[model samples]
Target chain A: MARIVTFFIMLVFWVLISGMFDAFHLGVGVICCLLVAIFSHDLLFYGHPDLLWVRDIFKVLAYFPWLFYQIVLSSLEITYIVLHPRMLEIIDPRLVRFRTRLRNTMARVTLAQSITLTPGTITVNMSGNEFTVYALTQKAAEGLPGEMETRIARALERE
Target chain B: MRELQEEAKLRMPWQDVILQTSVRVLIPFIQLFGLYVVVHGHYSPGGGFQGGVILGAAIILMALVFGLPASKHYISENVNKTLSITGPLVYCGIGALCILFGGYFLDYSALNRILPLGPIAWRSFGIFLVEVGVGIGVMSIMLRIYRVLSSAGTIDQGL
Candidate 1:
């Protein structure tokens, strides 16, 4: 079942990109896609068998808009800090440590990437549940692993 | 068993919930974009090699973040070895097919007899096929090199 789905997805992707529509092109696409699907289906869908796949897909889709908004907000904040006259004084760079409730590897990674993607904070290192983050300002570092962690946890929660 | 235990003990310093979650979310998109690059080479700046490298990097990123053992579960050493050969073989096979069809090496227009797509269309379609082959080959080779290098020529231990 997964193999068939993968083949169709690959075929659609191939047709969409190729745009030739000639019988020959379509034939090649089908053949190539089938070959790939047969060999690589497991790689495509490896791990995370517990979650409802459809629901998780939608959950991730819903999370993107919120993440983009957060990115914009942080970019603006970083720009303001960079342009400030007392930039050195305001930029109290510090490292913060925190642990999250999220247990799934995927969820944990998403939260870490979210932190790094947001302008003010960078995830310096991570081990098990704990994260060491570098923040550009004292204020940015203040609420370590707060809203973003919770939001990602919610987005990827198994239940 | 003792060596395996020692390897396990040489752990990365930190792991956070956020990093794990984000990588899971991002890897699929990264691979999809890589495929897009490979397929849209005619219309885009990217081509087979670039797209293949991107795909390989996605897997490498997974290995780096999640550890080598976890990645092997997705793409085992045996499968990787086979794929490394299969990609180039696909590319060369197409070329050889063109030759058997009575055209010069890599001459895609010769494929018209087999598919009736006109000489010009066949040529374009031929390029697409070659690109796909190249993409696969490059992706596997890159992954193979990274795997060997990180593990110090062994499939286990090291990174």
Candidate 2:
């Protein structure tokens, strides 16, 4: 079933990309997609029975806009810091480490990426539940793994 | 023996739960975009090589985040070897097909004899087919090289 889903997805993607409607083009696309599907279907679909795939998809859709807004907010903060006359005095660059409660790998990665994507904080390193982040300001580093971690955990929670 | 295992675990880089979670979510979209690039090469700035690299990068990202053994589970060495050859074969095969149809090598218009599509349409379709082949070949080769180099020619341990 997963294999079939992978195949159809690849086919639809191929057709969408290749606007040619001729029989020859469609036939070639089908052949190419079939070959790819047969070889790499497992790569695309791991098929964990416990996964709430549909619900998670919707959750992610809701999460991205929030992440984007956070990104904009951080960027503005960073921009202000950079443009300030007393930039050196205002900035207190430091590394902060903290552990997170999120267990899922996907959720963990999202948090790290979001941290890095946000301007004021960069995830310097991550190990297990512990993350070492570099923050441009003391304020940015104050609440380490606070809201971002909670939001990512909520976004990825199965329930 | 247990002491050595513990030491190894300590030496191994720590896994961040957030990174793992986000990469899991992002991989599918990255691969889908890669396929889009390959199929839409005719109309877009991207082509087989660029799309193939992007696809390869997705796998590399997986390996970096999840570890080598986990990624090998998805694309084994033998399958990788076969695909590396298959891509170029597909490309050459189309050219050979053109020859079989009594046209010069890589003459896509010759495909009209087999499909009865107009010469112009055949040419366009043929280019798409070749692009698919190139994309496949490049993607596989990139994965193979990364596997080899990162593992230091031994698939057992990867950096």
Candidate 3:
């Protein structure tokens, strides 16, 4: 089941990337997609998918808008911080550690990447559910595991 | 906090949830892109060798994150050997086959003796076949090199 999904996905991707509709190109695409799908179907959707993850696919798209918004907002914030005259006075660099509620491995990773993508914070290390982040200011540190975690959970599903 | 740091250091990369999960999500795409590179190599800038490296790098990425032993489970000793041998054989076999069909070595149009495809089509299709073989060879050999280099030629029990 997963293998078929992988094949279609690969085929679509191949077409998009190749930008060709001729029979030969299409035929080769089919062959290559089949080869890869058979080899790594499990890798794409591991542990007995059963069509549940198809819903997650749609749900996960909801995450990008939020993430992009955060990125833009944080980029502006970081720019302001960097351009401040009294940058050293406002910048209170510190390490922030927090345990995450997300149990799924992908969820935790998404949270970590979200945090890093948001300016003023950098994910330095992760151990299990605990993340050690370096924040450039007190404001950033305070936002640890904030609304981002919840948003990611909603988008990707928490295990 | 010191104890926490120490404990974090004790954990291996494969045991880290974030690394493992992110890799799972990213690896299949990486491989698919590599295949894309190989297939598109003729028309595009990249071909079998470059694409083969990408394919090999994907597996190497797996080994790096999952540790040598676990990576072996994914690729296996026997399969790796087969690929390494097969890649070159595919490459050379085509050359020899061309000779048997009355054309010089590697002259793909000569394949017309076996398949009734026109000489012109065979010429084009022949390169694709060679590229596929080369891609497979490169992917396998790249992984083999990494396995040997990282494990100090032991092919076991190291990164």
Q: Tell me, by DockQ, which candidate is best.
A: 3
Sorted on lDDT, best first, the list reads 3, 2, 1
Report the candidate with higher DockQ, 1 versus 2: 2
* All candidates: TM-score: 0.66, 0.73, 0.92
Q: How many residue pairs clash in each candidate?
A: 21, 17, 1
Two-chain complex of model 3, DockQ on C-alpha atoms against the true structure: 0.59
Q: What digit string (tens of lDDT, one per residue) describes model 1 on residues B20-133?
A: 455754665567667768876887789899999998998888888778787788788888888888889989999999999999999999989898979998888788888888
lDDT of each: 0.77, 0.80, 0.84
Show the lowest summed lDDT stretch of 10 residues, model 1 chain B.
Answer: B12-21
List DockQ, one per candidate, in order: 0.24, 0.29, 0.59
Q: Summarize candidate 2's per-residue lDDT along A33-67 as a digit string, tens digits.
A: 77666756655654642336667768889889988
What would the per-residue lDDT of candidate 1 be over residues A119-150, giving only the tens digit for each residue?
89998666667777889988789867877777
lDDT of 3 by residue, B73-136 (tens): 8888889999989988998999999999899999998899998989998988889888999999
Q: What is the lDDT of residue A74 in candidate 3?
A: 82
Misplaced by over 4 Å in model 1 are: A1-77, A98-107, A125-132, A144-155, B1-10, B13-21, B40-47, B67-102, B108-122, B147-159
Assess chain B of each prediction and give its TM-score.
0.90, 0.92, 0.94
Ranked candidates, highest DockQ first: 3, 2, 1
RMSD of each: 5.8, 4.9, 2.0
